[model samples]
Target: MSGSSKVKDGVSGLEFKISQISKNPPSLLVTLKNNNPSLPFTILKWNTPLDPQATNLGLFKLVDEETGKEIPMDGLKVNRLIPPSKEDLVTVAPGTEEAHEIVMNKPWLPEKRPASYNVTVSGKFSGVWEKYGDDLQASDLEAYLDSPFSGKSFTSNEVSMRVE
Candidate 1:
């Protein structure tokens, strides 16, 4: 499935695209593209372009079509500490994109039998203004995001995939 997210009045944007990239061990290619003409999209380091968590949670989800249940992800760990550095942040320049490979396996499914599933992408769009100042404060940024026209969270269109 594919979809694009736009900020208030299209100040900036993000595009999500997914496709099957592997066959043996089924996998999905998740691509996130920056749609802003000049401003760069910032994301947490080691995470997908649309990951909203300050910590890395792996940016993907699978849902069973029959029972409408989410597949429980095992061995997922949450990082409690956040380091400050340029490397801690990933910038997607205008017209650029980042891709992630997600392997599809039975362990991630609610049931062992093969079935149809829907994929969804979700995350937050960090404010670009935060990058301008050296001494950034969360309180100040929070106030700005609290504005009436803020565009912070986004969810992509559901794309269907069948596994045997």
Candidate 2:
């Protein structure tokens, strides 16, 4: 996965892969793996914007490869730009991986969509900075705590899946 910036932490070292979990419900499994040894990295949960961990959880879009048209995704809400309240960190140990399975239901991907479509996820992983200022409280620090000092932006390779 390529990022917007260059980071040395394991965040940039994450490897992404997508698979077709099921064709009946139209689901996809997205996995993030930490390829760096001796360096532990955290990824943001489903919400919270602009932080290191948060950067890794991105949005998914479907593209019709046959017609070159973009499919409208419904039921998928946009990310809220709320202030960081709690720290939802997923730590991946060296050579470990985490998977998120997405079920494409109505609005998100209608039950009757085209057969040839490619799924792409837009986002990146980030490395944490070593220094933390005293003025920042724990919650405040949560926003910048694992802030991306250097990292890469990620755009997943399109994985083709079809509806049964």
The lDDT per prediction is 0.54, 0.55
Error of 2 at 86 (Å): 5.9
Per-residue lDDT of candidate 2, residues 6-69 (tens digit): 3333345666667778887787777776677666655544432223332233356677777788
For residue 93, give model 1's deviation from the true position in Å: 1.2
Off by over 4 Å in 1: 5-11, 46-59, 72-77, 111-113, 125-151
- What does candidate 1's lDDT look like per residue over 1-164, in tens digits? 35444343423466667776665466677676777677655554333433333113544567888879887654356553433344444456778887766666545454444677787756544344423233445553445444232355555556777776
- Candidate 1: give the clashing pairs: none
> What TM-score would every model get versus the actual structure?
0.62, 0.66
Instruction: Report backbone clashes per prediction.
Output: 0, 12
Candidate 2 RMSD to the correct structure: 6.3
What's the residue-level lDDT of 101 in candidate 2?
75
The residue-level lDDT of candidate 1 at 59 comes to 48
